[model samples]
Target: MLCPRCSLSETRVIETRTSEGGRVVRRRRECPSCGYRFTTYEKVEERGILWVVKKDGRRESFDRQKLLRGLMRACEKLPVPLDVLEEAASRIEALLRERESGEVLSLEVGDLAMEELRRINKVAYVRFASVYREFTDLSNFAAEIARLIEEREDKHDNH
Candidate 1:
């Protein structure tokens, strides 16, 4: 690696560690000539799965920010922390990467989001599900609420 201070092309790695669940490698390096020390991170660049297939049959590249934005909109004014949202996004990305086919349907992504949101906050989950599932009428929203209530009741009964 080139030394940032002196523009020297020689450097030696002093330390290395894995981060982000081993998805990245953090390396500490020192310039052999100038003695400048710096750190760098290395990550395997895997081409992510193809874009989500919209219900209307449109395809686009997967965008992390867009996904985060959707979740953020749903989580607006909720007590959910930014770290929780980040962790949720990371989990979703990891899950998508695990698919052997290297492709996932839009509905699948939406389901994953809903699952995470449900664990984080019920209101946020409903907000996201309503828009993502394209609820057409009030009955759809009511049905979702009813389902959530039933789920909670079932959990309470089990406990």
Candidate 2:
């Protein structure tokens, strides 16, 4: 690795750690010449088309960061553990990859996100649904919450 301070091409990794459920590697590096130390993270890059078909008839390359950002926004200040969210994202990604066409509808992605968020936290689920479903008024939130409550009640009754 190149040293950021002196632009030296020689550097050595002082320590290495895995995080993000071992999906990412954190490397502590030092420049021998100037004793500059820095940290870097390494992640695996997906190798596939994985196009997303949007509602507006536009297709775009799949962006994992974009999805993670949305999840984080929903789970913000909600006491949801970061690893649980990451695992949900990972499962969603794996599900998409299992699809044969390498393409998925935008709504499908939103639905998957909603389901995953619901499994993590109801507040997060509603937060994500409010945006994904484009709530225009109070009724939207009320109806969604009512439906969620009904579903929970039904599941409880069944048990």
Candidate 3:
């Protein structure tokens, strides 16, 4: 690593630690030529997953931001914290990485988001599902709400 103060090319690592739950490595380095110290982070670059096959048959690379944005929108006005949203995103990414095919269908992504949202908040879950499933009318929205209620009831019954 180059020294920030003197622009020297040589540096010695002084400390190292894992960050982001081991998703990245944080390193502290001192420049050999100028004694300047700086921090650097190293993250493993995952190979690109195959493009998502859209409902219209269009192919596009998987985008984490898109997933995050949808979650943010659904979570608006909900009591869920930002950390919860971030953890949900991290979990989704991990699931994608675990897939043997390295390619995820758009439908699969939507399902994953809905599953996470359901655990976060019911209102948020319905909001996301309505748009994601393209609800056409009030009946469709009502049906989703009823389904959620039934699922909750079933869970309670099981316990």
Candidate 4:
């Protein structure tokens, strides 16, 4: 690594750590000549563009910020922390990228988002689902809430 202070080409790493669920590498380096110390972070560059196949058949590049915005909107006024939502967004992006095909259906993305929200907060899950699933009637909302209740009951039974 190059030293920022003296523009030296040689720098020795003094410390190394991994964070962000091991997706990021942080390194502290020192320049021997200038005795300058600095920190750097390393992250894997996404290999290729992942396309989002819209419901209308229009294709666009997958945008993490857009996804995060949707999640944030659903979580507005809730006790959920922004960092928790950010981590959920990162996991969703990683899951999408792990697919073999570069293209993903919008429905699939919505499902994944719902899954994450359901784990984070039930109210937020319903909020997102009402929009993404286009809940047009009270019955729709009731059905989803009922499903959630049933799942909780089943989980409790298993435990």
Using TM-score as the yardstick, the better of models 2 and 4 is 2
TM-score, per-candidate, Cα-based: 0.71, 0.79, 0.73, 0.77
Model 2 ranges with Cα > 4 A deviation: 32-37, 81-83, 153-159
- Best prediction by TM-score: 2
Q: Which runs of model 1 end up more than 4 angstroms from their true locations?
A: 1-44
Error of 1 at 121 (Å): 0.6
In candidate 3, where is summed lDDT lowest over 10 consecutive residues? 44-53
Q: After superposition, how far is residue 110 of candidate 2 from its true place, in Å?
A: 0.8
Ranking by TM-score: 2, 4, 3, 1
- Give the per-residue lDDT digits (tens) of candidate 3, residues 36-67: 88899797877866567788888888887788
List model 4 lDDT by residue over 1-159, tens digit each. 889999999999999998667887889999999899999989898999999999999999999899999999999999999878878988999999999999999999999999999999999999999999999999999999999999999999999
Q: Tens-digit lDDT track for model 1 on 40-112?
A: 9787776755567776788866776788888999999989987688668878978887878766787888899
Clashes of each: 0, 0, 0, 0
Candidate 3 clashing pairs, residues 3+ apart or interchain: none
lDDT of each structure?
A: 0.86, 0.91, 0.86, 0.95
Considering summed lDDT, which 10 consecutive residues are worst modelled in model 1? 46-55
lDDT score of residue 47 within candidate 3: 88
lDDT for model 2, on a 0 to 1 scale? 0.91
- The superposed Cα distance between candidate 2 and the true structure at residue 34, in angstroms, equals 5.0
